[model samples]
Target: MNDADLVDNLTALESLLQVTFHDRTLLRRAITHHSCCPDTAVHDSYDTLEFLGDAIISAHVVEYIYRTHPDASEGEMTAVKSEVVSRRVLAQVGQQLGLFPFICVDIANLRTFNERSRDSLCADVLEAIVGAIHIDQGTEVAREFVTRTVFPMIELVSTHAIDTNPKGRLQKVVLQRTGHLPRYRVLEQSGRHNDRVFLVGVFEQEQLIATGKASSIKEAGRLAAREALQLLQKKDKRSSADDTTA
Candidate 1:
């Protein structure tokens, strides 16, 4: 995209984020997905910025949580941090900011855009934005951005929200109820570098219960586990009803 277009998009993002980067170039870099320009030598992408931003975001969240909840124990702070930094949380934040429309992607591969998952892109863009803000302005400004924009959205999400960490939750629930843990096995993997998709199956005691597909193996596994848990819950309810009838 040209400078004018970049400026306009950044302006829109600023309105959405409620903060403006002093160096608009940083903001431009943040939104430039790798798929938009595979040749790094030709055009900038968000990967490097994402790496830096990830650290900055993590540190800021930890500091904020530590200070805000002084009386809360370390475990509580850890849980809050986990919730805040989760991929699911970041994707939600990105969606709220309408970042998807502004993503720099390959025009030729538009079909892939529709078919593939958007969560990774959204999370990457969110981190890249944080890195851009930190570089364009300063850590304090970036921290403020996190506090005002990101934190509020995360907080508004219900605490009793269904556990997004389905794999862990499923394992715990299974162990508690049946004294057995769920297992995940990769069923298939496809696509080329930077756009691969994984299919995973979740099993309990050699019984294949659920399967899912995603861009990443972990994501696919989690989804499969979630489906398996749901199926198991339904089975349990049916068993209870049969017992009552008898």
Candidate 2:
């Protein structure tokens, strides 16, 4: 994007975020996607800002949980915090802000092409915004931003005991075992809007591990991840038994 377009995007984003940036350049960097921009000396992309935002999110959310849920157990607190800081929730918040329209990215390599990439990109940009805001305004402003947007999700997480992070869990398993992340592909979608069924297939290095179906794609992906983990567990058990016998 040209300087003029960049300024226009920054203006739109600021309006959406309801904050004025003291460091306009910082705000610009937050929305700059590495896939579409030139690398700088200190950083090539939002990676650095995203890292800072992740830490800031954790610390702020932890403080919120500690203060508000004093009677909660360690496990309860852990669960709630996890949901609040999860990629899914972060991405949801980003989508609500409608930041995709203002993001600077390569047309062909757009994050909107794939569901996974879109969610990840949105979450990353949201985090980058948080990081930029903290740097430009201060921790207080950043905390307020998160408290208004991300903190309320805690209620939904606490109400639902089952976590919808199978993809994340399966990702760890695949990375540890084969040095690759598991992939989720949408196989089929059926039914009406209020009662739709989605079938998602989980693949490890091009081989299909399992397929899952649910009312929502996210739930279906989680089911597929669980199946993949079980398969790995069985394989591990067999290997352990073989070793013992030998």
Candidate 3:
């Protein structure tokens, strides 16, 4: 977009964010992509702001989880925090607010914006905006902004909040059963590089106990481990019942 169009878009974005900037330049830089910036030598892009925003978002999320869930375990709070501040969730929030259209990326870069890349861009921009708010308004306003935008995401994870470290739990189970740790192997992979899906199997010795599918291998492996853990626990209960009857 041209300068006038960009200015108008920024004005609309300010309304969306519900905070007008004292230094409008900060907001502009926050939405700027490095590819669009002429001076490569000068850091006039969103990278630093994104970093600052990440910290700000994390702090607020951790604090919120701590205060709200006093009876929750540390691991439970961490899982909730991880879900709240995750890139995927942040991108979803940005998408909900229609933030991607305001990003100042080059036309060339725009062509490469697939769904996965667009999500990544949205996530980065969300953080940069938070960073900009922190700098322009102050911590109190930034905290309020995060609380308003991000606190609601807790519902997305709350219903499914189990142990996030499923792999660690699976390892202990495998060690107890067979005196060897479980291993994961990719059973299937498909789709493009930026959005590939993986089907992973969790094995105990030569037996493939369970499998899980997801976009990332690490997540897929964790899922497989969770499934395997559940399967093993059920078998153990069955065995105890059989022994009692015998």
- Please give, for residues 1-246, the per-residue lDDT of candidate 2 as tens digits: 688987887898898998899989888778778876655614646778888998898888988777654434577689889888999999998888897877766768653567777777889989998999999999999999888778888656644533455566667667876898888999999999899999999999999999999999988998888777666656765776788799
- Model 2, which residues run further than 4 Å from truth? 41-44, 107-112, 162-246
lDDT of 1 by residue, 1-246 (tens): 687877788799888877876777777778887767777713489898888888988898887666544433576567878878888888877877778988786757655644135776888889988888888888888888887757775444313232466676677666776688888899999999999999999887787889989999988987897687667656765776788799
RMSD of each: 15.6, 16.4, 13.3
lDDT by residue (tens digit), candidate 3, 157-240:
643553466787678667877899898899999999898999999999989999999999999998888787666656765776
User: 198, model 1: CA deviation in Å?
Assistant: 51
TM-score of each: 0.58, 0.62, 0.63
**Which residue runs does candidate 3 get wrong by more than 4 Å?**
107-111, 162-246
Query: In candidate 3, which residue pairs clash?
Result: none
Q: State, as a TM-score between 0 and 1, how close model 3 is to the true structure.
A: 0.63
Compare candidates 1 and 2 on TM-score and give the better one. Answer: 2
Worst 10 residues of 3 by lDDT: 155-164
Ranking by lDDT: 3, 2, 1
lDDT value for candidate 1? 0.76
- lDDT, candidate 3, residue 141? 93
Which ten-residue region of model 1 has the weakest summed lDDT?
A: 154-163
